[model samples]
Target: MSFITDIQQRFKKGTIVEKLIYVNLGVFILTFLFNTFGFLINYNGNFITDWFILPATFEGFITKPWTIVTYGFIHTQFLHILFNLIALYFVGNLFIQYFTQRQLLSFYFLGTLFGGLIFLLSYNYFPAFTDELDRSYLLGASAGISAIFVGIATYAPNYQFKLPLIGYVKLWHLAAIWVLLDFIQIPGNNSGGHLAHIGGALFGFLYVNQASNKKINFFDRILELFKVKRKPLRTVHKSKSRKTKPTSKSTKADYQKKVDVILEKISKSGYDTLSSEEKAFLFKQGKK
Candidate 1:
């Protein structure tokens, strides 16, 4: 009872990443319980799982449209969920450091949505899958996890992660290996899964490219919340302080100048050569 109570409290106070993991874990346990009940009752199938796992064909999909996102929550194999939840714990935490909770959820659901669509398309279009389409279905959180991993790597390719035996490696290097493995595994047993992974990776790449070019700053909303709301004050006998403050355009121009200078240094000397201040400044501007 104490253990369950502790989990409930943690769930209440935890961040979005923890909440997602808990939801996935809960669903996994429920799935096995339902399966066990079905087995005891002499039932052949668990209609509960079928309603959530995505189907490859259009007819099958139209019946359960919600499976596009729900399938990410169900995992039958222990090893499958183990790898996915581990990856999510590390990469999802890294993701929230730079992006908002809402944005992370967006990337996750959108990635799953895109991956499912790609799987459906591939299964229907390719000659090899024409016979398998009727019997085919997709499951797992790999697509969503791939999106979060590749998304961060695309946003900051030079970012490094330290591995036990291999030392430090650039995020892009890991992302490249991830995509490459999926590509080479296309001829293997889980071709649909691989194709879905590529789709998620592609979304992550394209999304970051477009977002960086547009200079979108989702953190501005968060920053706005911390600002104190003070009433206007009357000037004391019209002092020099009465002058109007610099416009937003000028402020933005100044920020751009600093960013340009830092970017120049990175280009000339590499990101690793940057001082702590410069690296901090780059990260700040990136979120903005």
Candidate 2:
């Protein structure tokens, strides 16, 4: 009971990245439990996996639309969840340093959606994948992790990671290698999954570019199509006869300047080198 209480407490207090890891872990255990229960009942098919894993065909997707996002949390194999959660922990923490937690959620979920869409489309349209459609169901969190990884790399192309053997490598260079591997391996065993990875990577690249005011013309316009319209909050400003206060534009300018400085520092060094105060300031600003 104490152990379970501790876990509950940790989950409640954890950051979004940590929460996501916990959710994935929990789902993984539950998935196996469901499989075991089925096995005991003389059933061979795992209903949890069947209903939650993203299907390759449009008809399968139509029956289980929620799988688009749910599949990101489901993992059948131990190594699959292990690697995914590890990537999510590192990349997701890096992501939140430069982006809001809300935006992290956006990239994660939208990445999954786009990845699933690509999987379905490729299986249907491409001649090579047409035969594999019935048997090739997608599962795992690779696409979301790829999006977060590529998104940050796109945001700070010059950011360097110091590896023991290889010294320092630019973030974009690593991203390029990652994507190239996926591209080259697409024709191998996991065509649908690799295609989905590319889809997520594209979203991350295009999204960060568009958000950073770096327009790729047609691609930027296409990203704009993903924007969701929410009801605007109508605020009525009254005439003030009192002393002058800093204008909103001026405040925004100051905030943006600070952000630019922090981002520049991140580009130079890495996110880990930031002082606690700097991290706090960035986190505070990110929430806004």
Q: Which one is best on TM-score?
A: 2
By lDDT, the best candidate is 2
**Residues 41-128, model 2: lDDT tens digits:** 9998887798899988888889988998888888999988898899899889877666656667767877887788888888999898
Cα lDDT, all candidates:
0.77, 0.80
Error of 2 at 202 (Å): 0.9
| TM-score of candidate 1 relative to the true fold | 0.78
lDDT of 1 by residue, 1-288 (tens): 999999999999998889999999999998999899999999987765878999999999999999988887778899999999999898888776555666667667767877888998999889989878888889998898888889877766767776899987887899999999999998888988999889888877766665645564442342244342211111111122233434699888997788777655543434667789877666655534
TM-score of 2: 0.83
Q: State the RMSD for candidate 1.
A: 9.2
CA shift at 259, candidate 2, in angstroms? 4.0
